[model samples]
Target: MKTTILPLAALGIALAVPGHAAAKSGDVQFKLLGTLVAPDGKITSVKKDLIGLPAGTQTKADDNVVPTVAIEYFLTDAISVETIAGVTQHDVDGRGALAGAGLVSNAKIVPATLTLKYHFGKDGGIQPYVGAGPSYYIFIDEKPGATAVALGATRQKMNDKVGAALQAGIDVPINDKGLALSVDVKRYFLRTTAHWYAGPTEVLTTRHKLDPWVISAGAAFRF
Candidate 1:
């Protein structure tokens, strides 16, 4: 009779289990992700002597796919914090008759973001959330390699940047063990001042606005 009662209690607990859900008090997650960024506009440089290029010197921005890794810690079932990092490369093209004369070089932008997110609907195996936070950008590899300048070179000066980020995502849980798949989208509003140094003879400067859209897909696990 005692053995029969113990087996019955264990069966009841199993039958009473509910749908997949996040942890109640504390959980940590790690994820690997990739993002596709679409640059909103052409690259504009504000420097002295750069405006004199041939009318056909075409300047444009490039949108490339980037991969990232992030880690998150959940304070409660409803709230979490995450940090992610990614980078992309871009090139300036020379076109028209002045194609040979304008600055054509490569540069990169690296962004690191810290986000705070709010989760919703965790009891049904589908969790959706929205988040907002701040980001830091570092510009590198600025070289005046080639173009039509008195010194046959050009240089870009970009300041370290601070900006705002917003993101939304949904997670699909696979089981009670906290394994899930996620899809997310994020946008950043960033501003920068570009300065170009063209040889000893010239300099140019311009203020530009950068609003980048990013889409990501990844897998996550809770511990």
Candidate 2:
């Protein structure tokens, strides 16, 4: 009987706390962010390789910086949903036994993502959040590298794929108004199939892991 009463009393006190729901429901936030995209474009397996590949051949994708925007809406004081818009470009280059070889050049991707976030803290103070959600990676305008073209490959294609992202971030209030400083980080897990064709014949095919770390910092406005 005492334990039950103690628990109920604690809940009542917590609910009565001041500024508990400082970020009210139906609030909207807009952020303009500078984002860094760093991907692991390593070869996971060779499905088909007509063009001979050296033993222990590996690959890496170079990083890029891009401008991004995020829109968020609060469902409750502690829960919100957010989506981001951005396009980034990357280049996959050979490593290990096939060093200095370019495999795919100027591969652009639209990382479409939506997340449901749970936030902690009041509106006039620091709020930290964690989120997770599904993602789709759209590949565009990827060209066969110079080496691939020289090696009888004239075209390259990377298949679009479904993926997931885990996110964590913090929003720090700048003033009494609805302005904040925001920093966010997300880890994406995804894979894609690469195809290289020589004219009409498919010459090379491989599977690659494109797990990328995305970091962002920007100013946020809420109303």
Q: State the displacement of the C-alpha of residue 198, model 2, in Å, after optimal TM-score superposition.
A: 0.5
Candidate 2 backbone collisions, by pair: none
* lDDT at position 9, candidate 2: 78
Q: Residue 222 lDDT in model 2?
A: 86
| Model 1, residue pairs in steric clash | 46-204, 46-205, 46-206, 47-203, 47-204, 47-205, 48-203, 48-204, 101-148, 144-154
For lDDT, the strongest prediction is 2
Tens-place lDDT per residue, model 2, 4-35, is: 99998786555343442357799999999999
Q: What number of clashing residue pairs does each candidate have, in the order they appear?
A: 10, 0
Give candidate 1 misplaced runs (Cα > 4 Å): 1-19, 43-59, 92-104, 144-151, 200-202
Candidate 1 local lDDT, 59-165, one digit each (tens): 44457787877788888878999888777765544445545433434558788789999998736446789999998877788444365344444566656689989
TM-score of 2: 0.89
- Model 2 stretches astray by more than 4 angstroms: 1-21
Shift in Å, residue 206, candidate 2: 0.7
The per-model lDDT (C-alpha) reads 0.69, 0.91
